[model samples]
Target: MDVLIIDDDPTSVFLAKLLLSSTGLFDKLTTYQNPVDALSFIKVQLVDNQLPQVILLDINMPLIDGWQLLDALMPYQAQIQAKYWK
Candidate 1:
């Protein structure tokens, strides 16, 4: 399974990687320090049907929070397309 980590804290991301990596449960692990970049990645992945099986999102972020990210992706609940936002 694939996993995504979207947190602004480098320490948190590091610790999360340490813990999750130790378990050796995921096939692909990706991390992003910026919410916008993470969102864009998710959008591309969603379009390609490669969305991560799990996403470790930070509730508190600078530009966009976890809830906002989820809100943006909500469009996928029906039918997703790259044009949804662009």
Candidate 2:
């Protein structure tokens, strides 16, 4: 499985990666310190049919926070994208 984590905190992301890696639940873990960049990457992946089955996002960020991300993904609601927002 593939996992994507968007968090501004490096330590939180690192610890999450470590724990997830230890569980061996995912074949890959992609971390992004910037939510905007991460959202761009996610859109590309979705378009390319390579979207992750699991995504973890932080509510707090420098710019373009989680709520904004949810709004941006509203068009994909037919794909049930917002179900993963929490």
Candidate 3:
């Protein structure tokens, strides 16, 4: 499975990566400190068949928070849900 971590804190991101990596569950792990960048990456992934199976998002971010990210992803909700449902 692929995992995406979106958080502004480097320490948090590092710790999450360490913990998740230790589980040996994810085939791909991507981290982004900026929500905007994360959103952009997600958009690209949506069209590429490379979407993450799990998304660990931060509610507090500089530009786009978790809620905002969810809103931004609304247009693709069906696609995302279908991907996970499969």
Candidate 4:
């Protein structure tokens, strides 16, 4: 499984990565401090059929909060949900 973590706090990201890595369940793990960057990456991944199986998002981000990200992804909801259902 692939997982993507989006949070502004470096320590939180590091800890999450450490814990998830220790689980040894994920095949791929990615972290992004900037929600915009994460969104761009996700868009490309959607095209390549490499979307992350799980997205851990932080709602309190500065520029773009989790809600905003969800709204931004509204157009791709069907595709994203399809991947999730798989």
Candidate 5:
């Protein structure tokens, strides 16, 4: 499994990684402090059919909060959800 974590706080990222790492559920774990960068990464991944199985987005970022990020992802929702259903 693969997991992606998006957060502006380094400490939160570290803790999330540490806890998730201990579970040994994912072979690949990716993190991005900047939601903008994360969105770009996700867009590329979506095109490449490499979207993460799980996304851990922080809902309380400075510039772009998780809710807004989700709104951005709305266009890709169909494709993104299809991965899980299959």
Candidate 6:
């Protein structure tokens, strides 16, 4: 599985990567401190191979908060949920 962690804090992102890695769940884990970059990644993901099985988003951030990100992802909700249903 692929995982995306969006957070401004380096320590939180690093800890999540460590814990998830220990579980042997993800093949690739990508972390983004900037929501703009993360949003760009998410947009490309819709056309790319596959979206992350899980996305860990922080509610707090400097630019483009998590809520905004969630709103941006709304259009892809159908596609996002479909993959996990199986």
lDDT of each: 0.90, 0.86, 0.94, 0.93, 0.94, 0.89
Winner on lDDT between 3 and 6 is 3
TM-score of each prediction: 0.88, 0.88, 0.94, 0.93, 0.93, 0.88
Q: How many backbone clashes does candidate 2 have?
A: 0
Clashes of each: 0, 0, 0, 0, 0, 0
Q: What is the Å distance of residue 36 in model 2 from its true position?
A: 0.7
Model 5, global lDDT: 0.94
Q: Write the per-residue lDDT of candidate 1 for residues 1-86, one digit (tens) a residue.
A: 89999999999999999999999999999999999999999989877888887889999999999899889888786554353434
Return the lDDT, model 4, position 49: 88
**How do the residues 1-86 of candidate 4 rate in per-residue lDDT, one tens digit apiece?**
99999999999999999999899999999999999999999899999989888899999998999999989989998987787776
- Per-residue alpha-carbon lDDT of model 6 for 7-85, expressed as tens digits? 9999999899889989997889999999999999988987784778789999899988999999988998888777667
Off by over 4 Å in 3: none
State in Å the error of residue 52, model 3: 0.6
The digit string of per-residue lDDT tens for model 2 on 41-85 reads 988886777888888999989889888997897887765544444
Mark the regions of model 6 whose C-alpha exceeds 4 Å error after superposition: none
TM-score of 6: 0.88
Name the lDDT value of residue 3 in candidate 1.
Answer: 95
Q: Candidate 4 or 6, higher TM-score? A: 4
Q: What is the alpha-carbon lDDT for the whole of candidate 6?
A: 0.89
Model 1, runs deviating above 4 Å? 79-86
Off by over 4 Å in 4: none
